[model samples]
Target: MSHPHGDSKRTVWYRTQFSSWMIAVGVVLAIALVVIAAINASYRTVSLVLLIAAAAFLVTGGIKVTVSAHGVTVASALVPFLRRTIPLDRIAHASARWTRPREIGGWGYRWKPGLSAVSLRQGDALWLELVRGTNFVITVDDAQTAADLVNRYLPGPGEGR
Candidate 1:
């Protein structure tokens, strides 16, 4: 949704991504472990481990990135409790760029000294340069539009983008 109110434009944009391959692999491994457990009770412990792995995959399978009046929020599409929000006022600049998982650390949620990213794939991403000089990135489709919405919320002139 997009609308202009007074001097500022209001926009609420969101994108979601699901790693089906990860889920599929997790399920297959879990089933294999279940079969092994059925064959030998001693393998029940191993089966439990596989089950946990499957649960992890399911939990991290999907993510939704939202740009709203409040700020930018990244949450698990399946479990919203697993989320992070970056306040709009803290953002100095926003831009769209292509990035790979390795460039900002592996997929899913990642945090390093001056960088944090919720990179799901190697493609378009919205990059945010925070006021503190740290950077945040999230891989999503239509990143240009998302970045544009974020830029609107940034502080007035001289902030530089």
Candidate 2:
């Protein structure tokens, strides 16, 4: 969805392509697990665990990035309780750029030193520099629009590359 337009405090956007990819990955992984489990009785438990993990990853991978007057929130599907919110006041810099999964120590939710994000693809991401805590690198389809929306809400020192 481009942006959520309803009676809500914030307008949220979710990448349709990314969501589809995640779903496909989840299904394929689950099928693979089932095949592996059938090969050996001892592998059943491990296969189950792997399937569960893949399901969780798929659920959380469909991210909904909400931009409000106060800040931007990266709401997760599976792990909604651990959603990442970057307050505009706390943001020192905000920008967007082409990013890869390997750059941030793989995909999904990551926390390595001064960077973390719920990444779902290897493309342009919205990067935010906060006054405290590690910087954020999020996967968004319309990175430029998102950054502009945030700037409109709270203009500050930011750049795009």
Candidate 3:
């Protein structure tokens, strides 16, 4: 749904699909365990483990993405503690980039090895370079859409592509 205000400002929302994969794998394993349990009477322990694991996957796979007139928010099932918000005024520049998995290396949020290393995913990213020598970079799945949002709300100098 579109925001209530007529403002043209945009917000790009993003979240990783890894949790989905985990959930899928869990479901499959659970099914396999159930089948094996039916055939082997001694595999009750294995079946129980698989069932628990499957539940975990299903819970963690539910990631959510939401965008509003003000900013973007991403929520994940696997990482229940993760909550990130990028305000319009805090953003300096926004773009999308592709990087190798190993290059990104670390899990969850990551940055490249150089001074200007951006997010590793191919999603949208906003560069928030504050005045206090603090820079914050965030990535979202929809790059162009997110960029458009930033353009509408906070137009930087010469920022149209």
Candidate 4:
């Protein structure tokens, strides 16, 4: 986590690891497809699809969660609409401790029954209790620090002043 010099408010960046793996795997697959296409012309169609998929991953893969004094925001590197911003006031509680992807019906963006999650990898995450609809959860590299940072902005007991 690196902090900017001029920014007075606290800000933390949560880097994603799953997207890196996806892009790497996609590139290798695309290269193999091109090789196959050269050997046999019929494989060109498959190669095109592989290339498109690789490009999609490049555009919509990496995720970065930023926590500042104002709020917590989850943003996609390439797409602006993919960003989700939750003000610090909306955060009821920020806790660490996560479940496996399998428990939440695989990673990425998933919803099951009444629960929804945005997770890239299976590990510790910042489980957020929101004041609105449902809770929001996101997997992060450092959950303890994130939770502590979030908790710091939350209002204390019996003190709305």
Q: Which ten residues in a row have the lowest lDDT in candidate 4?
A: 2-11
The C-alpha lDDT values of all candidates are: 0.83, 0.73, 0.52, 0.72
TM-score against native, each model: 0.82, 0.71, 0.47, 0.69
Error of 3 at 89 (Å): 2.3
The true-versus-predicted C-alpha distance at residue 134 of model 1, in Å, is 1.8
Residue 81, candidate 3: C-alpha displacement in angstroms: 8.0
Better of 2 and 4 by lDDT: 2
* Candidate 2 residue 145 C-alpha distance from true site, Å: 1.8
Candidate 2 stretches greater than 4 Å from native:
1-21, 34-41, 77-82, 155-161
Please give the lDDT score for candidate 3.
0.52
lDDT of 2 by residue, 29-85 (tens): 988899999998899999988998777667766777766666888876655565777
- Per-residue lDDT of candidate 4, residues 1-161 (tens digit): 75634453556656654567756765787788788878888888887777876665554456777777877887766665678888988888888896687866665666776566766778888888887756778777787777877887677898662
List runs of model 3 lying over 4 Å from the truth. Answer: 1-6, 10-19, 25-62, 77-82, 106-141, 155-161
Candidate 1 local lDDT, residue 126: 94
Tens-place lDDT per residue, model 3, 66-160, is 44556655555455565565555555554444433344443334444432322334334444443344544544455455555554566557764
Write down the RMSD of all candidates, one decimal each.
3.1, 5.4, 7.1, 4.3
Clashing pairs in 3: 10-149
Q: In candidate 4, which residue pairs get closer than 3 Å at backbone N, Cα or C atoms, i.e. clash?
A: none
